[model samples]
Every structure is written in C-alpha cells, then in structure tokens.
Target: MKILLIGEYSRLHNSLKEGLMALGHEVTIVGCGDKFKQFPVDFSIYARICNDNKIANFLFKSIRKVIGFNLEKIEKAIRFYLLLSKLNHYQHVQLINSDALETYPILSRFLYKKLFQNIQSRSLLVCGDETPIIDYLFKKEFKYSVLTPYFEDNSIEKEFQFPLKYRNKNYRKTFNWLVKNCQNLITSDLDYEIPMQKMGFQTTFIPNPINTDKITFQNIGITDKIVIFLGINRLSYSKKGIIYFEKALEIIREKYADKIEIIVSENLPYSEYISTYNRAHILLDQVFAYDQGYNALEAMAKGKVVFTGAETEFLNQYQLQADDVCINAKPNENEIAKKLSFLIEDPEKINKISKNARKFIEKEHAYKIIAEKYFTSWN
Candidate 1:
C-alpha cells in the first residue's frame, strides 16, 4: 500500500516508516518540524508535504486567538491547510498530529463538503491526548482514527492532570466526536482498555515503539572509584527537570561530596557531553514521569545504569525492572539522593541492573518488533 504518514512525534514517523518499508509497503512521511537527525529512513520523495516554514507561528497565534470557534481564523487556517493538501494530493495522506485546528469548528464543514470532494483514500488520524476535531466532522463522514496515550489504566490520572481551564466548548465537542468516530483507540497497557471503553472509545493494547537497533546497548566500561550520575536534557532547566536534578545533586554532594559526580547532558556542543556520558555510571533521563525519553533510551543502550521511573514494558522486555532502571522518585531531591546512595553503596546490584538493561532492550524494543507493531496497526 502507498501510505502518507503525517507529523513527527518523537521520531515515531521514522520508526514507523522503516517498519512499513520492511513489510513491503510504500511509505512517505511529512514531518511538521525538524526531522529527527538520527533517523535511518530515506523520505526525500514525500518530504515536501511538511510545512516547516514560518507560517506555523502565524497559524499558532491565530488559532490561539480563536478561543471559541472563531470563524475568521478557522477559514484562514483551512485555506492554508487545503492549499497544502491540494498541492500534495497525488499521495494518500493520513494526518497524525494535535487536533486543535480552527478548521474543525468553521472550516471542516467546507472540507467535507467541497475541499476533499475530489480526494479519496485520504483522512486524518488523531492522537487522543488532547481535544480531537472529530465532533465537527462526524456527520460529514471524514475517514479518521484515534490513538490514545494511556498513562495508566485504573487511575484515569491523565484526565485529572489537566485543569478545567484548558477545557473549551470547541475542545469538548471535538473530543465527543473522537469517542464516536475513532476506528480504534490504543493504550500501551492492557489495563487501560477498560477505562477507554467506559469513556466510549474503542480501545486496543499496544506498547510504545522503541528503535532498539539504532540504540544498540554497548558496554562503556565505567568501573572506577568515582561514581557518576547523569541528567540528560537540552541544557534547559525547566522542561527537562534540570532544576530538580541540580537540587538533588546538591544534597548528595553535601554528603558524598567528592565521592560522586553529577553530569548533565543537554543540546550542547557534542564535544561537551560525549565524555560526560563516558565517565558516568548512571544517567538520569527525566523526572516528569516514570518513562524514559530518547535520552534515557540512548543511556541504557550505552549499558549505563539509568536511574528512572520509565514504564515497564520496554524495560521488562530486556529483563530489567523499575528498581533497576530508575530510582522512581518524584522531583524531590531528598528522594533522589536516597536512591543514589543505595546504588553507590551497592555496586553488585547496580551492575546486575545495568547488565539487565542492555539485554532487555536488545531482545524486546528492537526495530524488528517495533516495525511489526506499526504494520499491525495499519492493517
């Protein structure tokens, strides 16, 4: 099948495209922003669909101004998207991105009525984390699918995490449409299926895709007197939880002092961080959640003992446990310090977990398995 995958979500398109290729499907990707530099796929043929220009800023501001279905901005954005869509109509496209478009409120009626009147085998695929635009297009019969990032199954914690202020009538209407038109909604954990069903969205179980082959776990061999703790983010203190890591390091430095070193890796000069990871025994990925981002995955691939609360599926596939992967602490410095002490004092346990980390990812999160998952989803 000839497929057009739209939007780039944490290198998801690159991985999925590779999988699709292996399955003998023709795949092209249209990334929204910067393409993942490390992706191993060749998408030059279909890369033109990406709207990487300065217009994104204008669209964002205009959409923000449309608090309650502001029709003027909606028409403007629709004209923009439609022009892009018309330009790329040769390919069967599937738009996968955030669904807060002004087009849904004012322009979707037009999209369903006339814009796509000539187009077939093209539709939008919405991720179910935020407000979906399905509600407005339901009666219009737009081909669509919904995928949810179920953080947990039992708690329904994700919903509560967002406050009521973020809610808008437009958003609610779109979400209601998603619950009705979504071909399927996927959760990483099987436990989430029930909650999704309760919410009136069809649910399926699918783990997060990991490109294990590219992240090959190698033994960096850090057997020395100085223990290292790593924090990986783009040097920014706010988004990557750098402040929390710094506070925790301060507490540990007061006690351990010169015994341990804390190194932070951000989007800095490559020369600066290359050695930092090499010297460290443990890399701290993120404090926002138990799951590891690309940074954590890269650290684990290097065979370093990663202290994180990253989800279990990816780690468990390698026979690694939560205790082994991360310290599983909130952004509390004291809590992080306590976990650090345990790892420093007990080298044997650390070594065991580090060993498990490499093996688990290789066996389970490899590209071969990930590619298959993508194929299953499309089929």
Candidate 2:
C-alpha cells in the first residue's frame, strides 16, 4: 500500500513509517518536525521561511497580536497550495491530527477537504491535541487535565493561546468537518480514545509505536544514589502536571538529598533528550494521563521505570497491576512523592519494574506490531 502520513508528533509518524516499510509497504511522511523537537520526515513542510527569519517571524507575530491578521498564515497558505499536488494520489492518507497542514483554520479545512477527495482512504489520528477533544475536556470537570492550570488561574491565558482558538466556532467546525468525512478515527492513547468515543465516533485504539530495537535496556543495580530524571517543556508544564511533580520532588529532595539525585533536562531536542538522561534510573513523565504518552513510552522502552499514567483503565486494558509495570502518578503531590519514595528505597523492585517496562513495550507497542494494526485498520 502507498501510504502518506501527514504530520509528525513526537516521532510517532516517523516510527510508524519505519514499521510500515519493514512490512514492505510504501510510506511517505510529510511534517514540520514538530517545531523544535525536530522529528524526521520525508517531506519537510515546517514553513522554514517564517521560522528561519527571526526578524520576519517576530514582525509577523507582533502584527498578529496587535491587529487580527497573521502574515505567517498567509505565507503558509501559499506554501501549502504549492505542495498540494505532491500531497495527493495516495492509496491511504492519515493526518496526525485535523490541523496537520501548517495553514489557517479555514485554509487547513479546505486543504483537508481537498486531500480527502484525492485519497482513496482517509483517516485521522486523534493525537494528544485536537479541538473536539479539548473542547470536550473543558466541558467536563476532570480531576486534572491540560486545562486545569488555566481554569485555576486565568492569568495563564497568555500561555495557553491555542485553547482560545480551539474554543472558537471556526476551529470546531473545521475539526467537525474532518471527523465527519474521515473513513476511520485512530487513537494512540486512552486520553484521546475516551473523548472520541464520547463524541460518538467509532475509534480504533492502536498503541503508539516505539522503536524498541533502538533502545537498550539496562538492569539497574544497587547504587548509592537513585538518579531521578525530569524533562520539562515549558509549553506543556501545566498540562503534564509538572508542578505536582516538582512539589513532590522538593519534598523527596529535602528528605533524601543524600540518597537520591534529581536531574532535569529542559526544552532539549528529541535526540539530545534521550541521550542526556540515558543513565538515569527513573524518568518522571506526565501526571494527568490515563495512559503513557510518547515520552513515557519511549522511556519505558529504555528500561527506565517511568512515573506516568497507569490508571485503572490502562491497567485493566493491559491486564496488569499498577506499580508492576509503571508508577501511576496521581494529581496530589504527596501521593506522587510517596510513590517516588517507595521506588527510591527499593532497588530490587526497581530492577523488576524496569524489566517489566521494557517487556510491556515489546509486547504491546513494538513498531511492527503497531504497524500491522495500522495496516489492518486502513484496509
């Protein structure tokens, strides 16, 4: 099958391309490398003209903020229009999300509708970010969500510019059109699955593909200090529950400063990030997800005991017990600190969980296995 994946998020589509190629299918990925993270793709359409020229970028942003027009959007619209011919004529085309093309909402909707007409089968991946899901999440009162901080402190509105756009009628209509036209919806995690199902769309949950072969698993031995690593992205700090993790880490640090070492990597590219904390024993990932995101899953593939979403829903789906595979971080700082403290005090249990974490990735999220699922779903 000739498949075209139309976006890159945390290397999800890149890894999926590898898996599909291993299965002897022709796959081409087109994306912008997801901004600074710099994930690879066959066709790089990240709007380099606007991004490379800092002066122009700043000018355009300033104009957008002052007035209502976005010069960068106009530039992207022209670029996307020129690339439309190259983007067509595929057996299957899957968008990482509704907003795959780097254009304004109206333009993105038009391009998606055009692409849908050109492709034989069109699918949408309900990735971590989508307007419908975000809108739905805001409607309900989640114990903790990406919008928790924003709701608690309205001052953070400046930081969360996307959600404001997401709440707009234009954005909602664009996503709704894509959802209605797509042949099928694919969800990579439970966070997306729950909202998508609630919105009355039948979805196929395919675990995010992790290239396990690239990661080496190491058995953690008893050491003087337990190294806990936290990689922070300011853009998603509130959503990922970094504040809770930080508070928990503060307590743990004060209590066991001599026994544990906390290492933090902030805003590093994907390649540098994995290598930077390769030797760390534990990785503190997000706290508000029902299932692990790509970062957590990749750390698990590396045999790191990741503190992430391993809620009852995730456990029940995988038929495993919590704390056996991954540490389930709660919204409360005390609970998070307690869970971290438990692992810090026990070396043998960490080693056991570390092995289980890798095994879980191999059994469930291996690229080939997940790619086959994609193939079947597209068929």
Candidate 3:
C-alpha cells in the first residue's frame, strides 16, 4: 500500500513511516519537522520566508503582535496549499491530529478537503490534545490530567496556547471539518481513546510505534552512583507536570547527593535529546497520562527505567504488574519524590525495571508489528 502521513510529533509519524516501510509499504510524510525537534518528512512543507531565520522570526513576531494574526501560520498554509497538488492520489492518508498543518481554519478546511477527496482511505489519528480531550479534562473526568494545573490556576494561560486554541472558533470549525471528512478516527493511547469513546466516536486504539531496531537496548551499568535524567520542554512545563518532577528532583538531590546523579536537559533537538539520556539509569517522562507517549516508548526501548504513565488501565490492557516496565507517575510532588526515593534506595529494582521496559516495548510497540496493525486498521 502507498500511504501518506501528514504531521509529526515527537517522531510519532517518522517511526510509523519506518514501520510501514519495513512492512513493504510505500509511505510519504509531509510535515513542518514538528518545530525544534526537527523530525524529517519525505516531502517537507516549511515556510521559506518566516521560518528558522532569526530576523524573519523576529519580524513575524512583531507582525503578529500588530496584525492580531500569525504571519508564519499564513506562510505555512500557502506552502501547504502549493504542495497539495503533489500529495494527491494516495492509497491511504492519515493526519497526525486535527491541526495537522497548523494553518488557519478556513484555509486548512479548503486545503484538507482536497487531500481527503484524493485519498482512497482516510484516517485521523488523535495522538495529542484535541477538542474532546481538552473538553474532557475541563470537566474533571479523570483523576488528574495535563490540564490539572490550568484548572487550578488560569494565570499561566500562555503556556497552554496550543491545546487552548482548540477552543477557538476557527480551530473548532477546522477540527469538525477534518473529522467529518476522514473515513476513520484512530486513538494512539488510552489518554485519547477514553475521551473519544465517551464522546461516542468509534475509534481504534493503536499504540505508538517505536523503532526498536534503531534504539538498541543497553543494559544499565550502575555501580556506585545512579544517574537520573529529567527533560523539560518550557512550553509544556506546567501541563506535563514538570514542576512536580523538579520538586522531586530537589528532594533526590539533597538527600542522596552521594548516591544519585541528576541530569537536566531543556528543549534539545530530538537527535541530541535521545542521545543525551544514554547514560542515565532512570528517565523522568510526563506525569499526566494513562499510557506512554513517543518519548517514553523510545526511552523504554533503550532499556531505561522510565517514569511515565503506566496507570491501572495501561497495566490491565497489557496484563502487567506495577513497576513491571515503567513507574506510574501521578500529578503529585511528594508522591513522585517517594517513588524516586524508593528507586534510589533500591538500585536493584532500577536494573530490573530497565530490562522489563525494553521487553515491554519490543512486545507491545515494535515498529514492524505496530505498522501491520495500522495497515490493517487503515484497510
């Protein structure tokens, strides 16, 4: 099958493309490199005038401040429209999310209608926050979600512009249009699947594909000092519950200065970010999720003891025990600290979890196997 994937996020589409290709399917991905992380696409749709260049970025920011509209988004929309002629007539087409192109709603609706008309089988993969997920979070359905901080305090609204934008009239219109056009809706994890199901949308839940072949599992060599790595994305610091992890880190830092080493990286490119965590025995991933995201899966594939979402739903789905693969991190500072201290005191559990993490990824999220599942779903 010849498949066309649109958009990238933490190498989700890139890994899926690799998996599909490995299964003998021709695949083409069109994205704007997911900004900063720079995940590659077969056919890129980046704005030439308002992208990456320091001067252009400054000029565009200034323009947006005055014009009340983003110049960069318009530039990307125009670029995506021009590429539409080349993206047509695919056997299967899947968008990473509702805002796949990150363009203006009216323009995106017009452009995406063309793409949808051309593909034989259409799919919309809800891998991140969207209309329903945000709505669900606002209703306080789950015990704790990414929007927990925002609900408690609305002062840091700037940090939540992306997800909050789904509340925009234009964004909501575009989201509905995309859903209406797509032949199928797919959820990549329990975080999305639960809300989508409650909203009465029949969707398929496929785990995010991880290329285990690329990320070779390395047995952790922990002798005296145990290393822990925490990665922070400034944009999502509050949303992903990074502050709790930071507080936990502080506790770990002061109490176990002799036994534990802490490493913190901020907003590095995907290539450098993955490699930077190589030496760490434990990696701190997101706190407010019911299942692992792309980064957590990659870290697990690399045999690192990852602190990510492995809640009851996730464990029951895979039939695993607590701390079998990765630790389940809820949105609490003291609890997270307790979990870290438990691992710190017992370094032996870290090694066991590291090995289990790799095996879990290989069994549940191997790219080739996941690719086959996606192929079957699309067909």
In terms of lDDT, the best-performing candidate is: 3
Per-prediction RMSD in angstroms?
8.6, 1.6, 1.2
Give candidate 1's TM-score: 0.64
- Candidate order, lDDT descending: 3, 2, 1
Over 13-122, each residue of candidate 1 has an lDDT whose tens digit, in order, gives 66656666777777766442332233332332212222334565456556667754343444445444655553344334444433323234334333333433443444
Worst window of 10 by summed lDDT in candidate 3 = 43-52
Query: Model 1: runs farther than 4 Å from truth?
Result: 34-96, 100-128, 131-166, 188-200, 225-243, 265-280, 288-295, 310-322
Error of 3 at 262 (Å): 0.8
**What do the candidate models score in CA lDDT, each in turn?**
0.50, 0.85, 0.88
lDDT of 3 by residue, 1-379 (tens): 8899999987998889999989899899998887788888887777768877889889888988998778888988888888888877689989898888888878888888878777868899999989878877888879998888888889988888889988888888877877787778999999999999987788999998999899899988788799999998998898889988999889878988999889999998888898899999999999988999889999999989988998999989999998899999888878998999999898889889989889989999999999999989887
Estimate, for each residue in 1-379, the C-alpha lDDT of model 2 and write its tens digit: 8999988878899889989999999999887787779988887777676778998888878888899787766776776677779877689999998777756889888777677778868899987778868877887645667777788899988777765676778777877888778888899998888887777778999999998777667777756789999999988888788989899999999999889988998999899998988878999999888889999998998889999988888998899987888899888999999988888787888999999999999999999899999999988
Clashes of each: 9, 0, 0
Clash pairs (backbone) in predicted model 1: 217-301, 230-284, 234-267, 290-309, 290-310, 291-310, 307-326, 308-326, 318-360
